[model samples]
Target: MTGNGADRKTALVISAHAADFVWRCGGAIALHQARGYEVTVACLSFGERGESAKLWKQEGMTLEAVKSARRNEAEAAAKALDVHDIRFFDLGDYPLEMDRDAKFRLVDLIRAVQPNFMFSHSRFDPYNTDHMYATQIALETRMIAQAWGHNPSEKVLGAPQLYLFEPHQTEQMGWRPDVFLDISEVWDKKRAAIECMQGQEHLWTYYTNVAENRGNHFRRNSGGMAGGRPARYAEGFETVFPRTVDELG
Candidate 1:
């Protein structure tokens, strides 16, 4: 298929679980969408096997029931973020493994979107290997999509900036964020999105606190007591690719 207009900017986010995007980078998604970028979110799994505790606590909840409930919550969360295209691979989690075909499918999506930038989990996560594995797959798929001989008919992908969003436990995950985004303007939308994940309601306040802390970091880095814009909420990211630019702003 052909690519979109050159003026149109796009982005893709690969989440290990259905609700990972909301917690990790919902603010970035909302902020970019507001900036007129077409953002596509691809959730690798529903996290039914492990991530959904509230649903599992309920009586008589089958595997399918849990998956359905998680899917509903993720869809609601995506909607709250104004995300129009959100896909669930449903490959399973707690040990999320993707076969060759699944990798190819991801490659196709990457090539099709031709995103200017992308977001994925941290490279290392001991607590949840699924998160790191998803990033591994994302890197592999991105490489495959860039290969000219992989699929001659499809348009090859460009070298887009791959930004790793913050992990749950940054110290353990060794996730040092270099980019701090002030999402104060879109904090309300991100908060609404965070609330939509009913399965992980306990994390709502925790993530809110994270945003607030990151906001403080943003202010400190931008201009520590030197008249920087006061921010109420923020998100952080570590870029995997070196950003090329004519001038550093």
Candidate 2:
């Protein structure tokens, strides 16, 4: 981490599906953009295969409809965060298995951008195969990005620090948030970002709850409400870097 807050930071946020980013890390993206960081969003799938309840049975909710709506939503959300680049791999939804080809494609993306930080779902999520698989792909892609022999397209950019975003179902694997980012200044932007996923408004209430919950954590730890946007709200992550205390201390 740089001491100067004005440093140009870059971040890549990967998710199993389109709406996942809105639910998981929309606020974080907004926060990054507010700090002048370049942000990239990559979705493994459009989430056409996920459970839709009665919404899918509605008049015009075909699989294509869902995918198109998600694309538009992601676009609006990215714009709210000042993110210029958004990539969709169009992998199969619900169960996003990182086949050999898919893995290589993701690795190529990482090599191309070389973000300073990478955020994705946790591999410990057991209920969602797509989420778990997306994390697996991210993990493998991180390794491949640094490998000298593989991925000829990439010029061996050093590995970015990987962080696991808090999952929707946090109790399952238990989210241990080591880092809490105060995104109070961008909460409205974040809310608008989440509202971009109109197809999942009903499903996104869980995320609002999450933001409020994480906000309380931020307040408790930081000692007061801060930032330029709202009184509270944050995106939390667990750093996967294995380092000695000396490196941090």
Candidate 3:
């Protein structure tokens, strides 16, 4: 929306934890990168205390050690997906509180990326308050990015779609995804990225099944038993904001 040509096609993923993007929207990231779009992932935390239970079971594991391990895995996963950039805020999880400065920092990233669309966690996650908190931060930063008075020297952000990606235990989270992306083309890349989350090996299979089930939904929604795209793997997302179009389907 900011410019023309391939360089203008950009996307931002605001993840609550190091591996959230990998599990939720890894295929979208890889597929977008494959289609000449630069996708940047921003992780607020390394999920050291809350999401790194396996690593904590180690004999002599420390907080820094767990954080380092998660960071390494995220970097490798980003590499596998050919991500344009991956940033770690090191904001420590469990509560995942953000001060005014932290929110401003994210606003800066939003303006810099100037993404055509953005991805973040679900709005409500009782199981993981950190996930919902990340979504709140995503919405706040996006609004700040669009304000002219926030940083008059830089270009204000345009209206980019903020997509709320699906969450674990989604049934209880009230996350209804209206968008289904076919990631069959990049399923291998997604799987490779999923495998990189060595600390959270338990979730790897669960997410794989999620992709497969979402693929079925994609096919059915597109037109099942008639003329549907054969998507073997997919990801679902719920849109946070509405769009303004000249025409509607």
| Candidate with maximal lDDT | 3
Higher-TM-score candidate of 1 and 2:
1
Could you give candidate 1's per-residue lDDT for residues 1-249 as a string of tens digits? 123566878899999999999999999999999998889999999999999989888999999999999999999989889885899999999899999999999998998789888999999999999999999999999999999999899888878888999999999998989999999999999999999998899999999999999999999999989986698899999988876667877
TM-score list, all predictions: 0.97, 0.88, 0.97
| Candidate 1 total steric clashes | 0
Reference-based lDDT, each prediction = 0.93, 0.77, 0.93
What's model 1's lDDT at 142? 91
Structure candidate 2, residue pairs in collision: 185-229
Cα lDDT of candidate 2 equals: 0.77
How do the residues 1-249 of candidate 2 rate in per-residue lDDT, one tens digit apiece? 311134546788888887777777887787777777778889888887684444486886778777777788788888876775889999877667768888888888877667878889876887887787788788888887788889565478575777889887788966688888877788888888877777677766777777888877877776554533334678888887753344552
What are the runs in model 1 whose C-alpha is more than 4 Å off?
Answer: 1-5
The predicted structure with the larger lDDT, 1 or 2, is 1
Better of 2 and 3 by lDDT: 3
Which residue ranges in model 3 land beyond 4 Å of their true spot? 1-6
TM-score of 2: 0.88
